[model samples]
Target: MVSKQAGVDYTETFSPVVKMTTIRTLISIVVKQGWKIYQLDVNNAFLHGDLHEEVYMDAPQGLAVASSRLVCKLKKSLYGLKQASRQWYDKLTEALHSRGFEHSVEDYSLFYKKSANSSVYVAVYVDDIVLTGTNLVEINNLKSFLHDTFKIKDLGQLHYFLGFELLYREDGVLISQRKFTTELLKEFECLSYTAVTAPLECNLKLQAAEGPLTDPTHYRKLVGKLNFLTHTRMDIAYSVQHLSQFMQDPREPHLKATIHVLRYLKNDPILGIFISNVPDFNLRAYCDSDWAACPDTRKSVSGYIVMLGDSPISWKSKKQATVSLSSAEAEYRSIRMVVGELIWLRRILIEFNVPCDTLTHVYCDSQAAVHIARNPVFHERTKHIEVDCHFVRNSLQDGSITLPCFHY
Candidate 1:
């Protein structure tokens, strides 16, 4: 679809989207509380948005118009207009606000209405809405209101939205992208390829100049698809992150490694994260780093996973911006990364009116790093990472996070 001219035909195309982590967290909450979760679709959602800026379009064929050169002025948003999404979001937000739903400061797409007896959470991603709450009557009222306002279509119990396919079992909710994965493999002719045990090879060192150059566009598309799969499949997170570095000028070795990742996906495309229905809601975090893992840049790779009860809601595998002098420093930097995530997650939980413990436990295997966080006496060795030390230490002092030494 061709988009309208920016700044001329329209302005302000930005629209907030609900974070995948928030979606998973909500699912976990639903599973634990036995709350009813439903999906809503706004029919021709963009068309419901009222246009503030004057937009004109040529009349379509078969339209009875006085003159052929005469153009039609648009009173509402259209499919190809640049400002369509923002307009629709503004309209929806107004509707929800009028109904006493407050916007979440942490995630703009999340709107919640809380009362003494009932609470309703509505998350919006464009036209798709995921609604979960304790009150079924209120939910039905909401459905009727949306239907009257924007012709909302009730999709019933949330089985699929976006690319994720959710399975609501007795134990918990299972999320995966089996359909998307199958289509991706079929598109690339990798559906029949032999499955592999792992996403990447052990001790596989890929260089920017290694092997002959391949089609950079094809390599980028493969990497991009794999990166999306990482949302549900954390097993391929590090591999996809590693492959993304070669997007500018991918080489033959890079393509082969990417194919290896695809083969790994072939092994079990249905495998995904299962948010269990555990009673506990306390948050926990684990972080680790591989010192000088990148041969090309000598930069450390930081990996961390944040869990709510037994369900993993957020995780990331990223290369550090700068090289660390020591392994402890790398580990400390990783701790800092996770501490930030922990703080944000706690804020989100607070918005949900969920009680989080005073101090969320953060585990690290490196005793040196743990000592650095607690003692603050290793000035000579910790000066380079003083910023990270200060951030983590401040969180510790304020009782936001605790760095516990754990080996496993």
Candidate 2:
């Protein structure tokens, strides 16, 4: 055990993460079909792989050895090795490939195998694996195979994985972080605060604090967790994204606003996105932007929500990378990002063996932006745009995407 005393650079061992949106999309489809879901945890996952590099440690100065300069070479990866996770992934991928599972080209962690009668889907998050399939026989065989090959603790059903509390129903699954949120509220000593209807004031704009905080670490940590909570809590997405900007030098007002978010959570700790049982596979997207909302940097905020049927699977509210001279440019930039996500989402659906939605609609509130996208001319104002937003326009022309007239 003492051979693992030294820590390795986690960054070097970092593996690709399957997007949460992908997970949500998969869940929406699977739950709609009433498929069984199971989870598995690999014990000492990182230690199962062999080390390729010659990792060596110098002998202790006082220790007697044949040669003072002799070094010890590592044959297997330890828990903290720089290559541990990557090596483990390699070994796992090899094993899965041998078992007729194909690693997805779009999302590497997603492994699947489809036959005439059965299909199995596996979503991997580090050592934790969530399994779902149409055939229980195949799933059990794979589970037993994995257990014999690697020490796996099978956690029955997808009840709780990665802090998400899952309550399955005949209709669909209700996923929330009630326990996590409650503990977070108490951790921040805000369990007694009054709840509010909204997390942030409607017309108010937040900026960096006037002066340095007493201890900025607490403020940073609190905001970080709040941001993670946005994983399942879309109601607080905009507010958390707004407050995340001031993590470097947070002030009292920022802390107060963050506490406002926690209090909002206190309003409904069980508040989360509900995956519905609706069988509709139509893809619907709405993207909007607030131009020059940031008082400090004068950057706009771009927001979009993608729905599988009526339930949201992906949403984001983030500040624009570049300052848009006009509101139209900001909205147009948001269009670019959302369309890219649409393309990626469609590819993921195909990988899941789900049929593509024939008519995908991307709605934008800015009429001027829609007009500009439809008429892609090198206008003097749009000349400054780095990437042309002609993709959505082409989708419209090709009869794939329809820009419905916006009302209200």
Candidate 3:
């Protein structure tokens, strides 16, 4: 369909949506504050966007037209148009701005409106929206307004949205993709496969050209779905990350390891992160790296998890861009990556009126890396990673974060 459109019809196709991190962060806060969650769906969402560019389309197949040569001039955006999403987002922004809602600079898709007794947060994923706040009446009124403005359909209470299933409990809210996982398992014929205790084998190393090549299409499709599952299932994050490296030219060993992850999912598809109701907003992070983990490129893998109190809101397992000469350098670079996330998360929390005056604790496994980050002294060992050292040290110096060594 994109091939059918001309260059003048659309220029920008990139549309920002609410981030998964922001969604998790807000859900954690909602559970902590014991606020209500609501869901809204916009009917024919793309059709509401007003078009600014001059465009013409062929008339409908059954329409009674005066001539076959006549084309219809477009005034509103329609589905399949490249610019529909951007136009609709602009229209939604205007409508919300008129109602005192201010879009968050931290996250454009997130809009917040505050009054004397209430603060309402609305997260937009295109047409689907997740609304939450302390005031029930104000939330209902906003719902009414959105319906009147966009012909919205109220789904009521947020049990499911974006393939994630929410389970409210006495302790906290449980978010999972059990239904999605089940379908994934069944579709891949892994439902009846033997389950594994772990997603990947200990000390597992996959080579790009170790074995005969397999179907790249099948391997890529399975890996893509597994990547989406990692949103709720952090346990598979590392395995998915490792498996994705062989997508372009997958081999037999790569497919086997991928199937191992599928069996791990079959072991317990219901396993998910639990956002607790603890009244703590402190940010704590743990970062570590596997030196020379990749046998092919000898690139170390960086893994980190960020916790807001006991709830894990953000995490990642990625391969480093460059080879590190030492384990300490790899660890130092790992900490540097998390510091960026910590600062950005602090900004988001501050916007939510949460006090983040205390320094965040960043625990690392390598004492040498911690020493390198804390000490300003430079040596041959720290020369290559001076840029990373400066970043971590600056964050440490400003009281934004503290580097603490964790004993194994």
TM-scores, all candidates, are 0.95, 0.92, 0.96
The local lDDT score (0 to 100) that residue 131 gets in candidate 1 is 97
Q: Residues 165-259, candidate 2, lDDT per residue (tens digit)?
A: 88776767788888889999999999888998899877878777475579999999998898778879988889988998998889888888888
lDDT of 2: 0.84
Best by TM-score: 3
* Regions more than 4 Å wrong, model 1: 1-5, 64-69, 212-214, 386-389
Residue 201's lDDT within candidate 2 is: 72
Model 1 — TM-score against the truth? 0.95
Q: Which digits, one per residue and each the tens of the lDDT, describe model 3 over residues 127-237? A: 999999887887898999999999999998998989989999899989999999999999999988999999999888888877876467888999999999999988899
Per-candidate total of colliding backbone pairs: 0, 0, 0
Q: What is the lDDT of residue 389 in candidate 3?
A: 43
On TM-score, the stronger of 1 and 2 is 1
The true-versus-predicted C-alpha distance at residue 6 of model 3, in Å, is: 5.8
Q: In model 3, which range of ten residues has the least summed lDDT?
A: 1-10
Top-down TM-score ranking: 3, 1, 2
